[model samples]
Target: MQKINVLGALLVLGLMVQCKGDKKSVNKVESNAPITEVTESVVDTTPIIIEKPENIKVPDGMVWIPGGEFIQGAVPQDKMAMDHEKPAHKVKVDGFFMDVTEVTNAQFAKFVKETGYVTVAERAIDWEEMKTQVPEGTPKPHDSILQPGSLTFKKTKTSVPNLYDFSQWWNWTIGANWKQPNGPGSTIKGKDNEPVVQVAYEDALAYCEWAGRRLPTEAEWERAARGNKSESIYFWGDDDSILSQKANTWEGEFPVTNNKADGYEQRAKVKSYPPNDFGLYDMAGNVWEWTSDWYNTNYYNELGAVNGPVVNPQGASTPYNPNMPYAKEKVMRGGSFLCNASYCASYRISSRMASSLDSSLEHLGFRTVATVDMLTAN
Candidate 1:
């Protein structure tokens, strides 16, 4: 009976955008602030840092994350910790090169140009392939609803009365691809430096293949996002109040009002906020980055029983969410701009989120990592 996909369920955190209801309308931003310049490109177009250590070559736009042992989950007393992020367990990760920032429009543009990759959002939906994902007997979506497009957040005309009913804000916009993030009229020009959104897991993987990189495993992402620290509620520190302009999260009321106190209504340019100790930008906000891990709510609990740190822990072999056990979902790290304390506070360093691999949205993007083997192979 639901018109929206699982994306609508995952995004219904507090006052965050929800599925579009009968009240269809778009709220416009009235701000007249000048668009800020894009930050320096993460890709080092010049060949310079070749004299580094054997294990840490520091790829052009990437940084050397000297991986080591660290706690991978959340501890009790961290009131905000979710069930999936509990039972803090020790994990050991190998060193690798990580993109310093989320893959920007310019970077993905090059990949598209080189390989002519058609993103999942650009391809028409296949009902035969999709019906298997839903419970048997669920009605098939109308042919018109199967068009190529992606989910997008539209501000509510009024304050959201029910956070659980997200249909007031989330809309499956037709023609909403990465090239046109907002909808048919939106374009990526002038925002070339911003993180590319509306990317499904396959789209991100295609870009990785073209660039000779791979998506980071969930362990590597958490370890790197923590900046090699032992424990902290957030990437920056334990403090929750420090998430204002430091990260591009919602600063005002939920779907109704976005104060744009951080100088952004939607996604912001990479490096708009200060990097963590690891020198990684946008680790906390801007857009949710995809990870190469299957989603399993019980995965952490399984690791907790281990006697020692789980070395280079790959996620569960199969995806499983009790709420939607049949759906093929992948782990997503780092919260997006839509995250706010008023609704969803997933910006916590230890928080976790997952979405169907086929789902794409305006608030989602990804970065890639390269291991020693991958780098040498290239």
Candidate 2:
């Protein structure tokens, strides 16, 4: 069955990345250097002390993630883990500072007010790039339809014919930028602390640049997500019963009804739930956050083969998905409000999702991290 690919850019051309325009700027950097192998050293069984380097003031609202070796992908207890998150491997990342929560609308608004910046969803479609994602000779869309828009989730009243038909629940909402999350008439006036949504990868990059931060590599993100408890399916451990009380996620039937059993029908304010072991809120839910890694299903298969632990590993050089072979996809970690066991049970710590680099959706947002060297250099 042919599906309309409005939310996601359709049939991308030859994985041809680095498209032009503000709505579609991507830097697909590759590291040709060999993977640095972790070597055995004298074990310091003493509890590692967490302290910021002298003279380095910690960024406001960020916390230090003490770096250490941890399993990077799926742990054996994660029954919900998918193929992309499999073949759990050990990895070591350097200490870095991470935002305490998913970036909030108020925080993003501050960036916009200071820089007068416009997000990608607030810009009109670039047909030249759009055409590349669509089939050859596909007629250009009407000018009226080319206005700026993003995918906004509109819950279905009844069960969808099938879960694959995403159009059953998502609307192509013009004017649905981060400010108007549910499109026009839906303002963020009173919801400043909710996560800013409808932001594309480029939009997040712009924010990161303004903040003197960058999206964390997928490895770093996982490390933070695991926090001090690195071996469990969740930061809390293997039990799923307490999930509803611990995180903001879909608590009832998906795409139809949300029980709001967690007292939140949608995204709760930042810090609405308890923080993880690392003091990071919304690590398992609230929203799916953008990471610097390119999406590749077999990435773990490659990493799991390496000897010892992979040290401060960067992501795959290019995006790959046998299903959507051409879309320039990036990794989105953590689940969102709409994730559930009935469908997208990605709330597991090791869960992952992927989206086209050029696509923006209401449930998609990002947080950023800064390394010590980055702060000293800047």
Candidate 3:
């Protein structure tokens, strides 16, 4: 058993508090903080944009985003769009290829077998690690590290109006991972075809490296989701009412009652629904895809030229300012199947969310991307 330290417990408590607030106001921050300098120079002169090669054929079920400038934010009418998506800007992305579907359990299983990999959730916490988390004299909290790491949605006895109090639905469960998605009793035996859940950012990174792919940057993900179309509320178009047919989202009352109208109570199979114009499946709703960028609500404000010099925008290396204490969380894009209009309306193309780097959940998964060079080779 590992004891829960006061500091660590307090940190977790604070995160719960922060997550329950109005996302827009909770993420907003002042601009006075000096940006940390990085070694990489911002490319002022837009590198000569290369067109998608004529002979380039992505693997069996992938698409080539013939990357170019696209309006990358929400329109005024979409009350569903979060404030972080404001100040739409034009972003140019180099040509790249992205997976058409999220990584399925079958795909991840292959990677694990080949590498003999163990996910972060499977590792046990040593005394040193436990010491860092538990307060002095506190009894161990039942060996958290040894326990499988994942968030399980717990149905509440009473209907609660506060949708933001995710604690009502989210529980840190033991024995939950890509294999045992729902905790101890669950198994992925027959679900090898479904997208693997309970994967952290690091876990996704390892898979990408093994496959010679990389996580898509925030800008690249936005452009790919749009599929050369102007930014709209939904990936297919501006309509929020088109969810059931276009994507799998929570169809009924969130937390307590899920109508399962989309043919799934939890996550559905990848490509179980239709694909967008780019032939990308499950981009709007399925599992939230991980991005390489660190989250910052005001990242768009620094876009374009500033101070009379060509201002090159860079993603945050750490967490966004307002949420700095929760810096361990990484950015996740493309809302999951659990997302709904009534609770989390983040299923739109440009919407964003995040989770702890070590946190895993059934609603989270990832897609891979290849750079121009890698795409050319393929």
| Count of clashing pairs, candidate 1 | 7
Give lDDT per model, in order.
0.76, 0.77, 0.70
Leading candidate by lDDT:
2
Candidate 1: worst-modelled 10 consecutive residues by lDDT: 21-30
Give per-model TM-scores.
0.85, 0.87, 0.87
lDDT of 2 by residue, 284-358 (tens): 888899999888665666677777777777777657664454467789998888888877677788887788777
Candidate 2 global lDDT: 0.77
Residue 17 alpha-carbon offset, candidate 3, angstroms = 2.4
Candidate 3 residue lDDT tens string, 1-378:
322222223333434553545756655555763353322324456663447677766666567777575666776667877766776666666777889899999999999999998886665545555445334464445444334456666666767788766666776666677898888898889887688888877889999989989999888788788885574677778766667888878887776777877788777878889887778988887789898877665565554323322222345655654544533556788888788787767778778876656667788899998876786666
**lDDT score, candidate 1, position 136:** 68
The number of clashing residue pairs in model 2 is: 1
TM-score of 2: 0.87
What is the Å distance of residue 51 in model 1 from its true position? 14
